[model samples]
Target: KSLTSAGRTVLNLALVVISSVAAIGAINLSTRESSDSSTFLLTADVVAPTLTLSNSYERRDGIVLGEGFYNDWGHLAEIHRSTRVEASTTVDDCLYGWTKVDTYGTETFTGYGDQVEMIFESVGWNGISLLIKCPSTEQTATYPVMVKYVRREIRLLNESDRSTFFDTLYTTYTTEQVDGERAYGKKFRSIKRLVSEHLLGAADKECDHWHDDAGIMTHHIAFTLEMEQSLQSIDKTVTIPYWDYTQDAYELDDWTDSDIFNPAWFGMASPSSKDHVITEGRWAYMSVGKQADTDGVRNPYGLLRSPWNTNPTPYILRHRYVYDEKDGGWTLPGCTDFSSAWSYNSLGEYFDELNGELHGPVHIMIGGQWWVNRTMNFSATNGGDFLLASKFLWRQGYVRCPELCSDDTPDDRCTCSCPDELTRYFRTSRDFLDQTGLFNLSDGLFSDWSNFATTGCMTPDDCFDTVVKALCHVGHAGEMFTSAAPYDPTFWPIHGLADRYLSLKRIQAHENETILSQMWSYSHDGNSPSDTRRVCDWSKVGDTMGLPDCYVGDCAGHRAQDLLPMGNFLDRNESYTNEEFYKFMNPRNEELPYIYDSFTQWPACTDQAICWWNTDGAC
Candidate 1:
C-alpha cells in the first residue's frame, strides 16, 4: 500500500494510460457510423438539449413536460387527494369544480411532438434529436450525454475532413415538413420503426414508469408509455400524433372539406374509409397498431374522422396562432388573435377556458375513439382498475392507468364494471366539455400574471384533472385513450403544443433560478428554493452518462440515487392519499429547440427565430 515517490509516479502513469484507453472507447462507440461513412461524431457543446430535461424521466430531452398542481402530487391519488378535489363530486358542481381545481403546473402534451408540428409547423422529439445529430456530425467526440460527463474521457476536436458527411446524413436520414425538401423519412411509412427505435433507444428500460409500468407517463420523462410494448407486440415501431382543430383558422371553412382530412394529414374521411387504414397523406400507406387488435395488423381500412362541427364549428381556431403546413414553417397569429383567451390571465383560465374552447372540442370533433355523444359514456366491464375509457376522467391522455385493465385488454375494451366509481372520479363528456361557464373565457390578459408567477409558488389545484379529462376523452374508437396511440404517427406534434406552451410561458415571464427561488422561498410552500430548478433540470445538481442498460439497480460503478425520484408523476392524481407535491419549475435555458412562429411574417433566421424544423432556411 505504501510506495516511494518514484514507484508512485510509475503507478500514476499506468493509470493515465488506462484512462486514455477508456476515453477512446467512448469516442469509438459514438462515432460508429453507418457502413457508408464514419464521419458523424457527437458531443455536448455543438448539440444542446432543447427538450425539457425533467429529472423524473432520466433527463431525456422533453417531447412532454409538467404543469398544474395535481400532476405534481408525488404519489397516486389513492395516496392523498383531498375531498374537495375528488372527480366524482366535482361534476355535481362542475363550474365550482373548475374553479377549485388548482392550475399550478398541470399542462401536458399527451401525444407530444406529434402532429401539427409534423405539418411542417412543429417539432417532435424524433425530429429534435435529428436536428442535434445533423449538426453534431461534424463535432468532435464527447460523452453520449452532456450532464456531469467524465471530465477528460471524451476529448474535443475542432478539425476534421471537409466532408458533406453530416449534411448528406441529414438529407438522407430524414426530411423537412410537407413538400419542403422531401428527404427520406417524411412519408411516415419508411421511418416509423426506425424513429421509434431511436427514441426508445435513448431511454432506460427498467427505470420505472413507461418502461416497466406497461404504459407511458411523460410529465417527468420524455416517454411515450406502453406504446413501445404495444408496438413490440405487433412488431411495429414508433409514435403517434394529436391534431388540434384550434391550431389553425378553419372554422370559417367546412373542416371536413379541408385537406386536413386528406389521408396525408388527419386520416381518411370517416364514412368512406374502412378498417382504420390511412390512404392519402404521408401516413396513408403505413401499418399501425389497433385498439381492438393486439397483433399489430395492417389497417385494412384507412384512418377515419367525422368532424363534430364541420358546419360552423365551435372548435374553430380561436386564437389564430397557427403553424403553417411545414414543420419549420413560421407561426402566424390570427388577424384577431385570441390565444390570450386560452393562454393569458391565470393558469386556471388556461385550463378551464380551454376545456370546451380548445381541448374538449377536439374530442367531439374527432368523434372517433373519444366520440362525445350522450348516447354512450359508460358500460359494464368485467375486470381491471382504470382503463383507457377512464383516462379521459383522469389525465390529458398523457399518462396511462394500466392497473385499470387486463393484460390482454390493455389497449382494448375496459371490461371493468366500475361505472359508478368511474363516474364519481371522471367528469361526463358533456358536463366537462361545456364552454358556457368558463373561469375566465374572455380575450383578456392576466395583467401582472408574469410578475406574480415569477415571484409566486405554483398553487396546486384540481382544474388540471378537469383539463386532462378533456384532452384525454375516452369514448371514441380511435387513438384517444390507449397504449397504441403512438403508432398513429400523428400523436406527437399535436401534443408538442403542451411542451411549447410551457416553454413560451417561461420565455415570456423571463423566469430564472432567482425568480423561481423567490417564488419557492417566498411562497412558503413545503419545497426548498433549490428544488425549483433541480427538480426541473436535475443535471445542474448532478448527472452521469446514463446507464448502458435499463437496469434499475446500481450499475456502471455508480448508484441510481434518483432512480425513481419525486413521485411517480401524479399516478393517483386526485386519488392519491398524500398531500405532498413538488412545486418545482422548468429550468431548460437553451433557445427553444422548437418554436411556434407566425408564418405570415416569414420568421427571420436571426434572433431566436432560426428555423428549427427547416432545411435551407437558417436554423
Candidate 2:
C-alpha cells in the first residue's frame, strides 16, 4: 500500500533489525550442528582411531634377538567405533603416510586379545609397524627396536627363545649332508660324524691328544663354535644357551628336579625305557645312527657304538643318578668361588682342575654305571684262552693261581671265585679288546700283555694298582661317558658351560695381566712328567704319558699355538688355530659377535679378613 516517506523509512529500519537477528540465529544453529558432528566423530567413523603401546615386556635397553617382545594394544580402541589393529615387522612406505601399507617381513605377528608379540630374529636395527583403523581411514605407528645378539642362560630364556633354539638344534642335528674332502677326511654333517671325529681323538684308548690336556679347552672351544655356526646357518637368531649347572648344584636340594630336564628342554634325565632310550621331550626316540664295525666300517647294528655291547641298539642312553657317597648329586665345582680355577698360578693347573673336577665328573654324572652282582661259570681251557684267563686274573691283582682258583689247583679245570666288580671289568675289557681288534690271541698275548702292562706301570704291583684305578675310569656307560660324547645332545650344553668357564678364565687372566699363552705345561696325569714342548714342535707326537704315540691325526700337539683339528665339521675357509680359539674365548672380543647375559659370580670375599657373610660388618 502507498504510504508517506517517514512511515516507509521506519518500516524499512524495523525490517533490517529483524533480518540481523535471524542471521545471528542461523549462525548459532550451524555452530550447534558442528558440535553435534564433533560428538559423532568421537562415537562414529569420522576420525582415525588412536593407536599406542599400552604396555611392553621389552627391557629398557633393547629387545633381545630371537627372544622377541610382548606388547599390549588395548589402548588403540579409545574411540571404539569399530576399531581395528594390525601389526607387522616390516613396513614398506610408512614414512610417506600412516595409511600407506605395502609389505611385511618374515616374522608373523603373534598375539591375542589386543596384544602382539614378535621376534626380530636378527640383530641390529629392526622396526615394528602398527596399523590402526576406524570404520573409515587408518593411522600407522612405527617403533624402532634394537635387537641384541647374545647367548643367554637356558633357565632365563623365554618360551619363544627356547623353542627357536631347540628347533634349530634338532634341525641341524637331524639334517644330513655329505662333506667334501677336508680335515680328518670327508664325512657327513651329522651327530654321527661328530661322534666319529671325537672318537678319533681318543678311540677308547689311553693315548690321546684332545682330552685331559692343555689342548682340551682350545679344542672344545673350536668344536663348540663350529657346532654353533652350523646351527646359525639354519636360524640366525639361535645361540647355544649355556646350562649353568652350578646353579642347579647350589640352588636346588635335588638337582634332578631342574627345569633343564623338563619336556620342553633336554627331556628326561632318567628314561623309563629298558633300552635307556629317551622317550619324552623334543629328542624322544632319536636314532644315534649306525654303529661302526670292528674294521671301522659302517655296518652291523644301526645304533650308537659302545664298548660295553658288541651289538648296541639304536638309542641315546643316559644314566643320570646321584652318587651315594656324595649324599647330594654330583658336586659341580666353581659355584660361588671360581678361585679353584682362577687362583691357579698357571693355566696348566687351572685346566687340570677344570678337566678332572669340572669336566670329567659331569660326564660320569650323566653316564656313570651301577654296580650289580652276577654269577657266571667259565669252562677252563689251555693254550691262549688259559693265558687270557691268567692275564685277566693277574691284572685283577690275583698274582698267583691259588688266589683265583677255588679248587686250589692251577690246572685247566680249575674254578675261579671272582669279585663281581673285577668280573664285570674283565668281561667288558675282554669283549671290547676282542671286538675292536685292539688285543686278541692272534696278536700274541704275552707280547701285547707285556706292552700294555709296562705302558702305565713301574712294577707288577703298580700295574695291578693301575688296573684298579682304570676300573673307575672305564666303569661308565652311555655316549657321554665315552670319548664319543657328542652323540648325546646334552654334550653341547655341558660344553657350552665349559666355554663360559673358559671365557671367565680368559677375562680373569686379562685382568691379572697374565696371558693364557704364557702358561704352557702339559700335565695330563699329575704323575706324568710335564711336557713343555710347544704345539708348533710337531716332532713331539705322543702324550705326556709314555703310552703309544697315538695323537690327533690332523693337529700338531697340545699347545696354545697349535693348529686346531677342525676337520670337515668346521668351515675350511676359517683358520681355527688354538690361539684363534683362545682369542675367541673372550666374551668381550669383537670377533666373538656375542656375549653372555651374566657370568658366574665370584666370591664376595676379596681378602682373608673380609668374610663373605660379614664383609660389610664386623668379623
Candidate 3:
C-alpha cells in the first residue's frame, strides 16, 4: 500500500540488510501504519507530522479503532504526527466537514524525534478517515489508513500473596463483584494453570507458547503468581521473592558467590548437579505435573541447573553483571533497550534474535541439561549450535525435529502492525542481507549499550541491529527445556528482573504506559514438524500470527465479546466458553499484578539511558 523499502541496497559485506523495507519477503510487519507517512515532499530542513485517520462509523473488523505514534526521530529536528478523520467527508472536502477523535496515546522526544500516539477503537472514530500531513512544510495531504498495538496492561501480582490475581486479570471484577474475597482471585490460578495444561497437553506441543503464553511475555509472571499462591496456601508466609542480579553489593557477596546456592534459598548441590534439584525450600517438597518431556511423564526430578549451581549467574554471562558505580546500575545479560529495539518494519524477522540472545540465555545457563547451552551460536535447523526451533516444536513431548525450519519452528511468523518507531532503526538503502537465508541473521551487536550506539554511524545501523542483540548467549537447558523452562522456580525471578527492565524502558521512553493491543498466533502445524512455514510464519515468544482470525488455544473462531473464558484442553472438556465466562475476557486496561522497582534515575552505561540523557546527570 505504501512505498515498501528493503530493496535496491548498496551491497557491503561488513553490513547487511536482513529484509527490504518493501516488506516483500516472508517477514510481515504491517502492524501499525506509519503515523507520519504522507504523500507530500519535504524541503531540506523542515519537520512535519503524518497521521492515519478514521472515524467511529468506519466499523470493519469487530470495531474500528486506530492508533498513531511517532517512535523514530532520525531525520528532522522537530517532527510531529497529525491526523484528521472525517465522517461523510474528507480533510480537504471541508464542504462536508469532520470531527477529531481524541485518542492520542503519549508523546516523547528520543533525540531522534517526537514519538506521539493515540489509541482509537470502535467508538473512537465515526466515519472513514484520512491522514493529512507531510514530512515538511506542505499543504494538507490526505491518504488511506488502518490500525493500533496498545500494550496489554496486567495488574501486578500481590507481593504479599494476598491473592488479587484474577480481579483485573483475565476477568475484570469490581470490589462489589469481588465480594471482598481475595481467595476468589487467587484461586483463578487453577484456570491459568488449566490454560497452561491445555498448552502443555496438546498432542503436538508448542511448549514455548504454553510455558510463556505469547502475550506481553507475561505468562511467566502468571506462572510465578500461581506457584507463589500454591506455596503460600501451605506456609501462608511464603511469597515469591526476586533475585536482583544487577545490584552492586548483594549483602550475600554479589550474584555469582551468593547464598542463593544455600539450601535455605535455592539448594546448590544435588546428588547430581545435572539434575541439580534444589534440595531445600518449598520447591524441593513440591512435585511437578507432567513436563513437556519425552513421555509427558512426571519423573519427579529435582531442579536441574548448570555448573555454576554453587552460586548464581554463570561465568558465561558473569561479565554482564558488572555494576556501574556511577549510579548503581548493572548490565542485563542479554538485555535490549526496550525503548527502541526491534520496534520496526518486521518484528517477526527479528523475533528469533531476541529469543536467541535475551530469553534463551536464562534457560540455558540455569538448566544445565539438554546439550543446548554448550553452543554459542545457532542455526535455523534442528541440530545446529543449539536446540531452538525443535524444542519449541517438540510440543507436549519434547520431540526432536529431523531438520526443517518451518511452522514447527515457533521462532517466526507473528502477525504485527509496526509503527514508525521502526523508522529510527531502518533506512531504505543498505547492504545488510545475504542469500544464506531471508532475514535470517546471526545477531550479537549489543556488546553493551555503549558499544551498540557507537558502532553504526549511518543508516538505521545504530537503530535496530546495533541494539537488539543485547541478549544473553543461548545454550542447553534454556534451549532444551525452553518449552516449560518455568518448571524450575528460578525461572520466575529471572523473568521478574527482565519484566522490571522492560517496564523501566517503557517508563523511560514514553509518558503513556497503556498497551494499545496485543496479538498472538493461534495457528499451529499439525502433529509433526515441517519447513514449509517461512520466517514470517513463526510466532516466537508471544507473537500473534495469521490475519483476521488468530487465537491462543481452544478460544479459536470466537468474537471479542463472546470470548471470555480460560484456556483448557478440548479433550479434557474442562474449558468454559459462555456468557458466564464473559467476565474473564482480557480487558486490556490499567490493572497490574506487579510493579517494577523504579530506576528512572539510575546511572548510564551509555547515552541510550533516557534519564541520563534527559537530565544531563546520571543520578
Candidate 4:
C-alpha cells in the first residue's frame, strides 16, 4: 500500500493541480451566487509569505547605543511576491505584521504593516522579527543587530546622552565608598578622593612623578581613565564627554565667551560671588572637601590647613578670567600655536612644548595667580625704574605702561623692550613662584630695588635662577596655579584637552611608521637643582627613580617599565606600569573603550619637512 518516491512526487503535483482548479471554480461560483445566497466560499492559497530586509540598512554593521535609528521602517520591508496571482492581484499588496523581540526575549507587536521601525534600549545584540501574512499562511524572518558605546563631544551629545552623563557624574561625585579600614573605616571614592589622587601624584615634592617628564602623558591618561571608569560603573551607557578648547580658541574672538561656559555646560568662566564658587551649570553649587593652606599646599589624605580658619574648607575654588575683552592678558593658545605643537616629530620635544606652552597655560589662566595679600606697584618710581620693575608685569599683561607709549607705538600699544634673557627670567620666575614656595627676600637678588639695578644678570640662566628664587618667597597662587589644581572642575576638561592632543600625536606617529616604545625617553632639568627631577633613559631600565616620602608603595624607577607611584590611589588591586599606561594613550587603541569625536577644526601640521626623531637633522 506504500507509494514509491517518484510516485509520491507525481501524486503531490497532481494534488496541487487539482487544488488550483478547485480554487478557480470556487471563485467563479462565489462571483455568480453572491446576489441571492448568503454563503460563498473560496479555496485558500497554500503558499506562505516571505520576509526580507531592504537593501538600505543591510550593509551597516551596527549603530551607536542610545542614538536610535530613525526611518528604520524603510530598512525592513517585505520583498517576496505571492505565488498565486490574479490579473490585478498579488501578495505584494497584502498587509504585513511586524513584531520586535529584544535580547531579553520580550516580544512587542509593532503593528500591521509591511514596514516597522526597530529600536533597542540596551547595548549588545538585539533581535527584530518581521511577519508577513498572505490570504492563508504567514512567514517570519528575524534580523540580528549590534549596538555599541561611543564617547562624543559634549556639544554633540543628544539630550538623553547628556542627561545620562551628568547624572552618572553627579552620582559618583556624591556617593561615598569605603577606602580602607584605617581611621574608623573612613570612606572615599567620591570626587574628593579622585582629586586627592591627582594632588598626591602632582604635589609631592620629593619626585616629579606625574608632570614635566616623559611619563606626563601616560600618567594623566591612566588617571583620566580611572575617573571615567568610576563614572561608568554606575551607568555603562555613559561616557565622559571631552571639551575641545581648541575650537573656542580658534573660532571665537574671545575664548571665554564660548558656550562651554554657559550654565548648561561646564559653568561660567568667572564665578558670580566673592567665594569663587561656581553658581551655574551642571556642577553648580558643588563643594569639594580639600583645602589649600596659606603655603599653597594640601595634605593628600588628611584635613588641609585651611587658609581662613583652623577647620578644613570644603569648597571648590576657581579664579578664572573675568568675562570681559579688557581682561585680555591670559588666553588659551591660538590655532597657530596648536598647529606648531602638532608638527613636532620627536616625542620629547613635543611633550616639552605641549606641557609648558599649552597644558600649563590653561591651568594658569584658570586658577590664576593665587590670591596675594599685597600687589606691589612701582608706577610712582622713575620711568627707568618703573620699566625695569614692570618688565615682568607688562609682558604678562598684568600691567600697562601708558607713559612709555610713543606716537609710533607697536600694535601691543607699548614699545618698551626688555632683554630676551630678562623675559626668560620673568617666565621662569612666574612659574617657580606659583608652584614652589621656596623663594625669599633674604636671597638678596630682589631685596632692594638698588640690588636689582646693580645685579648685572643680563644672561638668561643667571637671571632666571635669580628672579625665580626671589619671587618664590613673595607670592602664593590659587588652585590651578599649584599641584592641587584638581579642586576646580575646569582641571578635568583642560587635562582632557591634553589627552586629546596625545591621541592626535599618536595617530600621526603611527602613520609615519615611528616606533612608540623608542619615544618614551626624555631628559629634563628642574627649574632649580633642589626641584624634583626626572631624567628617563628608555634603554637603561635598571636605573631607579625616587618617589615622594609620602608614597608607601614599591619603587618606581626612571624607566618606561616602572609602575606609576600613584596608581594605588585609584583603588585597583594591580598597579599599571608606564608601558601599560602608554598603550592606551591613543584613543583608537582597542583596549580603550571609548573614542573621541573628530577634531574637525584643529589646525593642520605645518612643519612637515622637519623630522623630530631624526638626530642627523635629515628630513
Model 4: per-residue Cα lDDT over 1-619, one tens digit each: 2112322332332333333422331111111122322232325542322233322212232332222221221121211111111112225644455555443455777666544444444332333444444434444444433232344557666677677777766765566545321311322145656665666565433344676666777776666666666665666556667666666665678666887777766677656566667777777767655433333334322333111111122455555532111121446765556656655666676666656666666765565432221222211111111112222232232222222223243323322223343335445553443422223312322333343332355554554455433232222233565555655656665666666666655654655634333367654533322122422222332222221123222224335887875454223354777877667455444324444544322321213333332333234
Q: Write model 2 residue lDDT over 1-619, tens digit each, in one string.
A: 2122322332232333223422321011110123223322433322122232221212422432222211111111111011133332322221112221111223244333233433444332233343433322334344333233466667667788789888877865676545312222232245666666666664432234676577877777667766766666666556787776766666677666778889778787767676567888888887777544344312123344433222244567776532122211345543444444544566677677666666666665565332211121111111112222222332222222121222233233322223443335444444434432223332333213343343345564443333333322222245665556787777887766666666655654556534454455544442211121212222342423121333222234466677776733223355666666666565644334455544432222233232222214233
Which model is ahead, 1 or 3, in terms of lDDT? 3
Could you tell me how far off, in angstroms, the CA of residue 33 lies in candidate 1 after the best superposition? 45
lDDT by residue (243-305, candidate 3, tens digit) is 444231213233334444444333342213333344454334333332233433221121112
226 in model 2: Cα distance from truth in Å?
1.5
Best by lDDT: 2
How good is model 3 by TM-score?
0.36
In order of TM-score, best first, we have 4, 2, 3, 1
Q: Model 4: what TM-score? A: 0.55
Model 4 regions lying over 4 Å from their true place = 1-148, 179-188, 279-285, 290-313, 321-330, 373-476, 513-518, 523-558, 565-575, 599-619
Those runs of model 3 whose alpha carbons end farther than 4 Å from true positions after fitting are: 1-203, 206-218, 225-240, 248-255, 269-275, 279-356, 370-385, 389-480, 508-590, 597-617
Better lDDT candidate (2, 4)? 2
Tens digits of per-residue lDDT for model 1 on 491-603?
43344344344343444344321111112111111111110111112233222322122112221101112122223222222211111111122323211111222111212
Q: TM-score for every candidate vs. truth?
A: 0.30, 0.54, 0.36, 0.55
Cα deviation in Å at residue 332, candidate 1?
A: 16
